[model samples]
Target: MPTRPNYNQSSANHPIINTNNNNNLNQISIMNTNVDITSYVGKVLNINQHQVIVEDVLGQGGFAFVFLVRSSNQQRYALKRMYVNNERDLT
Candidate 1:
């Protein structure tokens, strides 16, 4: 079995309510753990000053995971998370 990552939820103690209005603020979370694609659903990620909420996994490979995400402005985007085990892979 794969171990799930420990992600810090934006409002773990508070219940999130969607008002059907897109003006609501997006929740935030900090990710720091091994990638388990299934665990990323419903997680809000902060990237390049934008808040992207992960909806589902679109694809996956041995070293990466592609997600179908929605931005705070209700825009859909593909977010890819890649992993490199060694320094050589950076080149």
Candidate 2:
């Protein structure tokens, strides 16, 4: 009888798992704070080393929200935040 190859040691396992790990590495860095309507206004959000001052909510749909944000230099931008609680949401 022939033995089945051990998939655990397969070279193919590295890339897929590493890619998922890299993605999760960025994702798990996000704040896990319970963000609500009250928590947004007057709050400062830091993204990619840029400091964004949350001014007001631009819009919202489902679990995603777009807020009006301004940089320290007065540049304006729309910041979109998604609420994800588990693996299903991440997928």
Candidate 3:
């Protein structure tokens, strides 16, 4: 009877799963906590307890400001504040 080749042994030499890929995966696990928000004002409008505001001065013909907010559950989100010519124009 012929014996089957060891598939497990072949997988050990696979090019896709190597040392370099392992190192990259380790680097991605690190978290970044240092970010400066002071210089962004004017460029940024208002900053709330859970969000950051910034001006959309480019006049893309859409919104006026942008906001970065964090949810109660810790999820991060971006909010856009549009420009309205009149207070009543908002809907």
Candidate 4:
């Protein structure tokens, strides 16, 4: 039998998942608290140390909203914001 590869290694590209026994229920809340679909145009978000400016909302789904954005270097990107109300779906 082949040995399983260790995927929990630390890397800049991957987020580390700590399997601790700390159960902080206070931090476990719905991803989207706002019910209204507010436009994020003209707003800047710092993701991964890069500044991305929201241009407009491209589309919206039952649980997600895709926004058209541009990076500080003028690169276009589509940012998807999803709402996970059900805790089971998070797993």
Quick one: best lDDT, which candidate? 1
**lDDT for predicted candidate 2 compared with the true structure:** 0.54
Model 3 quality (TM-score)? 0.29
Model 2, stretches more than 4 Å misplaced? Answer: 1-35, 85-91
Model 4 ranges with Cα > 4 A deviation: 1-38, 86-91
Tens digit per residue, CA lDDT, model 3, 1-91: 9543321111111111111222233221213223232233334222333323332111122333233333454443444334445435543
Evaluate all candidate structures by whole-model CA lDDT and list the values in order: 0.57, 0.54, 0.30, 0.53
- Residue 65 displacement in candidate 1 (angstroms): 0.2
The alpha-carbon lDDT assigned to residue 65 of candidate 4 equals 64
Error of 1 at 44 (Å): 0.6
Q: Encode model 2's per-residue lDDT on 6-81: one tens digit a residue.
A: 3122111111111233243353234655445546767876565567776766556677666666788876676666
Tens-digit lDDT track of model 1 for 1-91: 9643433322112222222222322222225545466788888776645677887676677766666777777767766666555446545
- Each candidate's number of clashing pairs is 0, 0, 1, 0
lDDT of 4 by residue, 16-77 (tens): 22222124222322345574444466777665445677666666677766566678777677
The per-residue C-alpha lDDT of model 3 at residue 8 equals: 18
Ranking by lDDT: 1, 2, 4, 3
- Every candidate's CA RMSD: 12.4, 18.0, 22.7, 13.2
Q: How high a TM-score does candidate 2 get?
A: 0.54
Note the residue pairs that clash in candidate 2. Answer: none
Off by over 4 Å in 3: 1-63
Instruction: State the displacement of the C-alpha of residue 14, model 3, in Å, after optimal TM-score superposition.
Output: 36
Candidate 3's C-alpha lDDT? Answer: 0.30
Ranking by TM-score: 1, 4, 2, 3
